[model samples]
Target: MTINQAIRILDPDTSAEALGEIEYYGGLRGKEKVLVACDEACRIAVEIMRQHLKE
Candidate 1:
């Protein structure tokens, strides 16, 4: 995902760890936080996809 779209990229290996980071960043947790996380995730997805597309 483009850096413009989000802060850090999340991975399966660090999903749990990232969850905690997100909670602290968003200042909340649970489903609500997941909803808010969409924007960030979308940014990451776009960045990764775009980079792959570049090659």
Candidate 2:
């Protein structure tokens, strides 16, 4: 699925989790951690793609 769709799916899962550390973390925090996680993942993926292109 697309990133947006993946976010939609993850949003609930994050929210439904027991509040402890991540839930109240609060801008790319709390249940929104997925947003940042996705960003990092995308960045890594892009970097890997660029490396392959250089080779």
- Give per-residue CA lDDT, model 2, range 1-55, as digits (tens): 3544334434656534423333456534655765555565566656667999999
Error of 2 at 9 (Å): 12
Query: Estimated TM-score per prediction?
Result: 0.44, 0.46
The 10-residue segment with the lowest total lDDT in model 1: 1-10
- lDDT (Cα, tens digit) per residue for candidate 1, span 1-55: 3453344435656566666666776754555685667667876777789999999
Best by TM-score: 2
Model 2's lDDT to the true fold?
0.52
lDDT of 1: 0.63
Off by over 4 Å in 1: 1-9, 24-30
**Each candidate structure's count of clashing pairs:** 4, 0
For model 1 the TM-score comes to 0.44
